[model samples]
Target: MKSSFVFLCISATLAVLTITSAAPGRGNANATIPANRTQNGTVTCAGLNDQKKALEGFIAAFVAILFFGSNFVPVKKIDTGDGVFFQWIMCMGIWLCALVTQLVLSFHPNNNNNLNQTVPVPFEPEALLGGFLWATGNMFCVPVIKCLGLGLGMLIWGTVNCLGGWASGRFGLFGVEASLPGNEAENFSGVALCLLGVIMFVFVKSEGKKTKSNETDDERAHLLFSKKIQAETESTTLKDMSKASDDLDDSWVDRLNPKVKKIVGTVMAIAAGLLFGVSFDPVTHLEQSNCHNPQNGLDYAFSHFCGILLTSTSYLIIYCFIKKNKPQVIGEAILPGLLVGVMWAIAYGAWFIANANLTQTISYPIVATAPGLVSALWGIFIFAEIRGVKNLVFFSFACALIIGGSVLTALSKS
Candidate 1:
């Protein structure tokens, strides 16, 4: 126990050091950014250096996609007590990760940024609203993953998230100005193709809901028993463990029928996507609402993370009361939670950087497609979530649609 605590402290210190390492040289990066602006009011690359900004945007999109796809990997390691408890710790980690960006951008000299003169904005706390909304939406993630499997779950939510976020930036939803790429029709086409890809995957038939034919009830019970023993230390026979398991399966989520599980999973995934669509709402709101110093870029990252922490905490508090002050506390969640938080922070950091350098129309679609691809890959190869030649064929076609759509979206900006 002490060792885990010590490890977490060291990891956190490293996170700070890693983020701060780039602080002094931020100007080096700022030098690369183009001074781009849209007449509609969103901040993106100035038309002056189109090729350069596109390249930078693509890079940021790549990073965001990779990290976002893998952020939940740590949660798979330990059994989260009630998921809410796990989510709370995960959000705490996310907040800590957000601090890295907040510190770097807050303390760094912004005068040197190439876009400074054009954008002329300062950090705004309104970004907190974006984070808060996102946190509220994110609470459904664990359940979604459990229900849909990573591939279908991520694909559905990611595709929908792409639609919402891109539409918001494209048409200026919720007070944000529209982001017009050079080719509006082509941009819409890309989003449509991605949507098509999601539809294809929907029919791909992931055999995830099927229980293993070989595993008997006794074996399943033993595995659960062993996990509990490892998580907290208990020595008992299989019969005793089986008895304990019968009494503990009380949550409605645990009692879901397979068909209901599929339906609920799909619904939860859609909810997650809708939430993701608006996760950045507050930041956009600041730019559109013309709040004080109405800045764009990484400056909003800190407050956004704080919003996540705040919203998540509120949920946990409500949950405590709902469960009669018996919140399921997962002790093993700390280090993994921190790691996952950093992963998301890094991904979001890259996303903010992409927002600064790329057209929202292009960046959003490209980013949205790739993470679903990544998660699908993990599901297929790592978790055996999908198999059989028919499924593989559909998977290939779906991937083609996603990749093709992402390319189309990126080209729309060009």
Candidate 2:
């Protein structure tokens, strides 16, 4: 019963993303789809929706927010490798879904019978590069999780991701043009609220490193040993402990300095978010770039996922040699990785649809806020990574900020 409801919810969420943004071309972030404009400023597609469509779109947005927010839940249960091997599995699932989508789209004709092509055809180079950019950011995920935990890590990066994706479209960063359908103040104010939320989240300590503090403590093992065993094991454990400390001291990334680890994780998280934000730059280029060869949606999806496959494979191969040809492989972790891959593939697939249907200015902020909500819930209830009355209060405040920002952003479209 529970599983069925979850599946139903997922379907409904995908429906919202597909229905709300599916018509694309032009849209306000409110519960409605606006008419799409052509390059020459003429209304090319009407995109007017009945109440039924509007309602469905609203419901689907609700579902999408939850699903996108919680899609990474599976990864929390299992132990993954240094991220390369696990990332490969996730990318494989993304590609699998994209391949299926492409095959399905091949049956449909995007152009008239004369052109004989699907929608968004021509397979632009920039579109493929966009996927690679996203994959590069994803490569740092595991290390960030290990150090920062999901709640804090996702919050920090999610903010940056939202800002980057939204800003590029809002202000036309990187030569991509803005396609916002509403007043500028409405959109920018929403962005400000979102930024305020991110700032609030940053001050909330995650109690993350404490989880590892005991594991690294030399006397932890001594406490587990019996009285007589403690006496004998003390010498052995102390020696082993010294060796363990030495081992930690050897690696630059995994060094014994907590401050350094925190800094590395934070930097990686920032980079990951920035990369993810730019992942859709090619799609924007297709719409706005002068040299762009607009391809069909199917080809775009295929090329994007292909980038994920190609880039992830290269990263995994590089990591294999770095690990001295003995890469860590956990058979048990594969299932979890696959699960996240499938879920993320679906969510991301919807993302493309949403992007096509609505500009990044309207969609990215709402989509980005979800994972933090879901992950923070997991962190608090499932993992106990977040604790203390003070932090909980901050968590509540953060949630309010996110909700307020999202609502204002949506209203900006109206």
Candidate 3:
């Protein structure tokens, strides 16, 4: 009975995400690939670069959506198994294997040349702190799933995660503490307002001054004619674009209008955390079922492998394309990703072990709420994702509603 209501709430929350930017390509965050500007009015069949990129996008999104959507079901299915250790080991192993493969391939092509070496930057304490908050939050998520069921955990963590994200957008980091209490009734009201503010930011379109497209062509012809007279072998386009990529270097990362960045990043992160919170449920269920056939325990390992593979592969593909200098970023991302992965693995693995020893209704909530509250504090003080004085008041109001709702929901379980 408790599970059903929790599931219902989660479903409602997911519906909201789907309606508001969850489905993809509906907002600015998803870079708009203009269809009308395609070559010959059709997607030109290009070499591997463009084709690979296009296919990768589709595959990555497909895997991600599937991975997130099925998390609850898998956890539920595996509720009866003693195989938690094996399942988790294989899942983490799968991701590690993938990472190893990337490293091997990167260095294998040029054993002597250091062309692909990463530029070392001093470890920034702020980035590490941000990563720690994420790792800790992820560690807490597993029990949250078990206890709060899917919906309420999503609500609590999702909101707090948003606060962390907003901080990242504003201050380029996520662990500051907000002075406001999250448990006041007024805090709940902020949820609706926050949602509205997010929609406004995401959906609002801005136009840059339009320019004539052909002006460049005429200029190009004149330059080419001049080049021919000078007997130069090069085209001017090559010269103009030689220093193009670094053009944005002059701008500060915080140049993104701090207030707007804070709001948008917070909203995006919150939505992402909410979606991610619900993503692992399916795998949890699959492991719990222990419905291993005559084929053996390989079924459990294989199924778990499938889920992790989908997630890790999808992430790699997406990050590779979206962050063009991915080779450089790989060093930065891997350690953090591992930290997050292990934290997440421990949380979910522990939940499975506990579920095996105790009833689903009793053990899950305890673990879930522990991180629920901890993450809130981390977001406020550590990440400082919350905004102004008014936001502090709003945060307090939302926190109250969240606490009241959580209490009421928990009490209703009896």
Candidate 4:
């Protein structure tokens, strides 16, 4: 089933790519040029460029949403341990994708000057700040998941992420220029609906089995007993030692008081959402500010990814030091981590394109909230994590709001 799904995804992606490549006005430099201005001071692109840009932006956003929603599926069943090691491995994959992107941009015909020689894209150090912000937020995932569970944690962070990202672009926060959509009322309403939908997701309980950390003491003990009986031929002392080691490896979040854990998880979720919201600020700043020549969003991808890799490595080193050089590392998680990273990189790259073609105000809410719908679908159909009539009803309602919100947001830009 997984193989079939993978094949379907690949085929769909290829089909989209073929269609996009053949689309009218794509890659036409003149398409984006301001050909005229109306009496109201609104700028308009030439001919079909405006329509084409909108199409491209929506397509890129769809791809981003799909990839972001499914990126973690590979590692869903794998033991990621503390996640720091897994994140570092994933960063490696992200960096590899960035390297490939850099190479492609270098060899692209557009990079050639009047002399017909390729001009290498300059690395923008400012973009590295975005990477640092993203990696720092990612460091909180395991704790948040342990403390709040995946559903609630995602609900809080995803809502904040949608609102924060939309507001940043809409209000010009953190030195980015404000990007107002053509239809202010529609845009604001869309964002509000999207946030509402995301908030509603918290009420949809998933029936997936609890993790070891969430399991009751009796349940854990019974599981341990079963394991002991299965390995009865082995030494009892060794088994006791192994269990002790496992207990020692447990997350500190698991040991926290319930009330304290809730507070910490909520705080972490908010912080992560804030960080994720502003993670693209540096790139936006570079494009808007005169401090540096304006560049395409893709040009900054390598620098941003490099920052992620560097920050993740630094965090991993600190984590190892804190764990006395015995940080939790699951060997089985390495490949899945890399795969997740690669998928994230591709999704983020598409996000960059979407942002460039359709202002962040128009794209942020859709990208941030639509993924929840996709993920919920995955849970309902593939994972069977979400079940029961009540959950399904809530999921359907949330999907309606999100899809409606996205349409309105897109139309606002148009």
Give the TM-score (vs. native) of candidate 3. Answer: 0.32
Write the number of the candidate with greater lDDT, choosing between 1 and 3. Answer: 1
- Candidates by lDDT, descending order: 4, 1, 2, 3
Off by over 4 Å in 1: 1-48, 113-123, 143-156, 203-222, 226-247, 254-269, 288-295, 380-387
lDDT of 3 by residue, 17-136 (tens): 322221111111223243423555655433333344333333322322322333333233122212222233434644453343233333332212354453211112222222233333
lDDT of each: 0.71, 0.67, 0.35, 0.81
Give the winner by lDDT.
4
Ranking by TM-score: 4, 1, 2, 3
Q: Write the per-residue lDDT of candidate 1 for residues 126-218, one digit (tens) a residue.
A: 787888778877888777777867668877787779888888888888777888898888888888888888778766765542448666445
Q: Write the per-residue lDDT of candidate 4 for residues 306-335, one digit (tens) a residue.
A: 999999999999988887798878898887
Misplaced by over 4 Å in model 4 are 1-31, 36-47, 111-117, 209-243, 291-294
Model 2 TM-score on a 0 to 1 scale: 0.74
Error of 2 at 199 (Å): 3.3
What is the clash count for each candidate, in the order shown? 2, 11, 54, 0
Q: What TM-score, computed on C-alpha atoms, does each candidate reach?
A: 0.76, 0.74, 0.32, 0.87
Q: What is the C-alpha RMSD of each candidate to the true structure, in Å?
A: 6.8, 7.0, 26.3, 4.5
